[model samples]
Target chain A: MKTKIFGAATLWLLACGPAAAESITWWVPNWDEEAARELVASYEEANPGYDVEIVITTWDTMAQRILTAMSGNNPPDLITELQSRIVLYASRDMLTDVTDWFDRDLAREDFIDSALATGTFDGRLYAVPFRHDGSGLIYNRDMFEDAGLDPEQPPRTWEEFVSFGEALTVEQNNVITQYGTAWPFGNLDNAVVRYLQLLYDGGGTFFNADRTGVELDSPAAIDAMQRLTDTILTNGIAPRSSLEIDNTGLRELFANERIAMFKGGPFDVDPLVDAGMNIGTATLPGTGGIGTTTVDGFSVLVPGRANNPEAAWQFAAFIAQPDSQTRLTATFPANRIAAENERFSAPLLQPFLAQLDEGVPKPSAEGWGEMQRILFDHMQSILLGSATVEDAMMSANEEINALF
Target chain B: MKRSTPRRGFLARLRTDKDGEWAPFVLPALFVSVLLTVYPVGSLVWTSLTNIGPDGVQFVGFANYVELFQMPRFARILGNTIVWTLLTTLGALILGCVAAVALEHRAVVLPGVWRAILLLPWIVPQVASATTWKWFYSSEFGMLNHMLMTVGIIDAPVAWLSSALVVLPAVALVQIWSTFPFVMLMVSAGLQSVDESVLEAARLSGAGPWQEFRDIVVPSLRGVLFIVSLVIVVWALNSFTIIWVITQGGPAGRSSIFSIYVYESFRNFDLHRSAAASVVLLVASLIFAIAYMARLRRQS
Candidate 1:
């Protein structure tokens, strides 16, 4: 009788302890963790029996960490990967297909077509985009006025762009005191994206219609490569030091008044405004009367090995809603409804919003990153005068073709 | 004890039964080593032979190795690895030996403080050092260029990290700076084992400082130098932090090394190729490791 009473007391004590809760781990870039944490809190409040643990990760090591986790079969239930990497992950079978969620839970028409296109692979949706980012020209108004150019009107054609750059460049005794623009001539993301924009503006495609062969040796590509190299070598508008600069470095140089103009996305507006700089926005210059730019962004994905994929999808869907999207200041929302909020239509983001109509997503082929590296190296060679534009483009074309 | 007379042979005593007394202590360690070291290495080798990609893992034995060998970049990358390892290792050793010998000399003052100061490079984190070096090498606003310009050394600022011709050497200089301190500390510790009486005898024999160093000091520190060199060779061969932070093997792959090659492949999601590259690096490192072990055995 005493043993039975003791057993009953142990069972009661065990029952009195906190209940076991299903937990889902979410990994996101460090930039948006504050808003993500708030979303996670709201997700937990709405779902009583589930808990969401958000882990902040940095861009430098995110790919390595994700690969390691996926190989070990211990990846987070939910992760926000750059749009460039989502297709790579899906191709590797590391992400789950969530086509049903788009069809049932959310109205597919509510998202911008270009933003939604980033998450699809082979007619199946493997991720949902939360932000939309694309490059544009951000010029210093004071420098524009100093150059005797109209501060309100920006260059629309390639000829005007070159002239404006030449006019804005300040030199003393043959040594450039102030660069007209920041052109990243090295193996930087800015250079790669800008090259893509140039290619698009010239009405060129990276891959052929069937997506089997690269068309880098085409006339449009040659033109883009030659123009980019001339911007540094012949035009002397951008500094030679740009060969060592990245996208972030470009922005920093522009902010420090080392450069008068540069290219960046909507996210750069806030910092420049906060730093008390008079900045003006303009669409990226076009080649043949068609202004175009490359769009790149981040998407949320549920890992294939997620213990509770349903819960992870629920959290992803929740974050994609207009309410949560409105809070993101770092990037413009991909959701059309959220992007229509009064905050995004301000003068600072007006040019970027107008650019959405002309923004083209980067090619989502496998081995695209490697192809980018090849293109970057060849472009650098051309800019450094080690290789001619035609030769570099031909070599890049061959290397990219060999990737498949 | 009762069954001792029934033992079959001396060789039979080597085999331990499952319930043997040493099993509890030895089994855990053996299990852990197999789990951590042996299993992973085996897996790496296995993965190198397979195409573990989007379509899932498939057996493609030696295809990855063949492809790696055929790639034009592989030859350049291998040559770069050799050049980088030899230069960085030797550069560090020479600088380290010089500093160590200088500090050990009787005429030197504030020996303790000097030794500590010399060790600052190795103690400081690699990322911080790389970042500082990047700023110092910046073409527009670097301290080095600014100082050179101030001293009228050059009419124009040199693009230290941008130009392909100068990038590899520039990165190697940073590697040399960061790692020589480690060599210095090791050599300094090794110097404590050198006998002062032998040096005095050399001095009494009318030997000058250079001759004494060449004859007495080098012979005495040969063993220490050898081990330090071996450690540094392995370290330099596997060095990634300095190069990756500085160049990312850029300026048209002028500074590309074996480690960076492998890392770039992995970053591109080419796992099989990366594994093959790592295996090649392992083989290179293994040659040095075997030499080190053989020398160690001979000394013992």
Candidate 2:
């Protein structure tokens, strides 16, 4: 009688154990930790017997950690990473091909084209983008009024951008107490992105038509380089401190009223508002009108070697939904329907959204990391007056092409 | 009263045999070293001979090394590494020796307190101090520039980290600051061992402070100086935290060294190139490490 009872219990456990509890690990950056935990809790509540584990990563260590993880046999079932990094992993065949799942569950037309493009490499989607944004003109409204310029009208052309910068600049005792604008020329990544914003705005492409090599020495690129360097070197409208700061430092300068304007993203709005500063936002000015901004964002990817691909996909698909995206995104959601939610309708964010209309995805070529470093070095040469814009761009073009 | 003899165990034999005893005791450490150090290093060397990428790993012989050498910036990066290592090592040695000697002077008051105060830079965490130094070196809002300008030393702010011309030295200064205290402590210990009779004889011979320091103090601390210099040279060659935190080898690779390049290559997923660079750095560091080991063995 005892043996029969024990056998009956063992049989029941064997039949129902896995069905009763299934767990999947999700690696997310610290910035998304709280939101991801809340989402995981909600997901667990809605679906019985499903568990999503959250592993917090950090900006400084995430790239190296992810590379190490993906190269190994074991990896988290899901990862929330930068969209720009998707191609690098997908090219390695380290990510699951989510194209079919995306098609079956999410509406293709509802997502932004550029955001989707970041996850698409070699004509297959490997990730589901949740958040997307591009840089816009984030300015101080009171500084604008103080400069005697119309606070309502931001620069719509590159020429006006320079002129307005000059007008807003404050000089006292020849020390230049305050500057008109500044650039994030210190950090290699931020410097490259800022330069790319100008390069794209002026109708220059980073790669040739076939995407085989760089076209940094093109007329459009040289023009962009000259205009960007001229802000500090020739025009003297910006402070020399531009070379010592990144985007975050630029925001602090703007907050302290040290500079009048800078190129920033929608995420800067809340912090600036919270600091009690009256700010204005506008699309980046181009040679003609609204310029192109480099679109980058976060996406959820399933590692190719994930233990639970099916369950990870279900959670990923659920997160891609409009409501989930709205809750997850710190910036604008990749889903157009979710972007239309009342939370994103604020005036400060509208310009960033408008900028997104002309946004181009950042280059995701295999050697882009090394290529960007080359470009950043040459750009620095121009800013430091060690090399001319033409010479520096020509060198950058050659060096980058040599990599290919 | 003949009793049955108890059998001796292997451990008992090992403990009894003095010469062979250490082998058993050292075997675990030897095994750990082989597992941790030799295996990883051998793997790195093998990886350096292959191309690792998204496609797959392909054995490419010396292609990675050839490619690294052929790169346009290789020479500049190598030159930067040598200069940075030398600058930081020499700067730390001189500054530390001087500080140690100063604290040892008879006129000095509360030498311990002064030594402790001077040693603060070394005691502070590299990340924290380097970050603070980065802000302090800022051209616009930095206290260094502000103080210089306020003192009428210069009419304008100096771009300590922005200009390629000044960036390497700027970062090297921070390296020197963080490491000199170690040199000071070593020299201070060495200073205590200098024979007092020789110094008294020199003073009785009417030797001035400069002569005494140059002849007696300098000669007495040669071994300490030699060992300290080798240790610091090794540290400088392997230096990453200060440079990485302060400049990230930037403003156009003006301050990039071997370690920075290795890290950058690794971050870019060019693992093969990173491995090759690591081997190069390992070979370079091995030269000093071998000398250090030889000196230690000779002393022992």
lDDT of each: 0.82, 0.89
lDDT of 1 at B116: 92
Candidate 1's C-alpha runs over 4 A off are A1-23, A68-75, A92-94, A288-290, B1-21, B53-55, B105-107
- Model 2, A118-143: lDDT tens per residue? 99999999999999999999889898
**TM-score (C-alpha, index-matched) for candidate 2:** 0.92
Model 1 residue B147 lDDT score: 94
lDDT tens digits, residues A1-404, model 1? Answer: 23432343344324322353567899988998888888777756655666888888998899888877877677899888888777777777778899996565576777778888888888899888888878778999999999999989888878788889999999877567788887765545667888888888887889998888999999988898788778888998888778777777778889989888887889889899999999999887787453787887888889899888876876777776776777753678887778888878788888887787788888766777678888888888876679999999999999989887
Residue B264, candidate 1: C-alpha displacement in angstroms? 0.7
Q: Each prediction's TM-score against the native?
A: 0.90, 0.92
* Whole-structure CA lDDT of model 1: 0.82
Q: Could you give the DockQ of candidate 1? A: 0.43
What are the per-model numbers of colliding residue pairs?
A: 0, 0
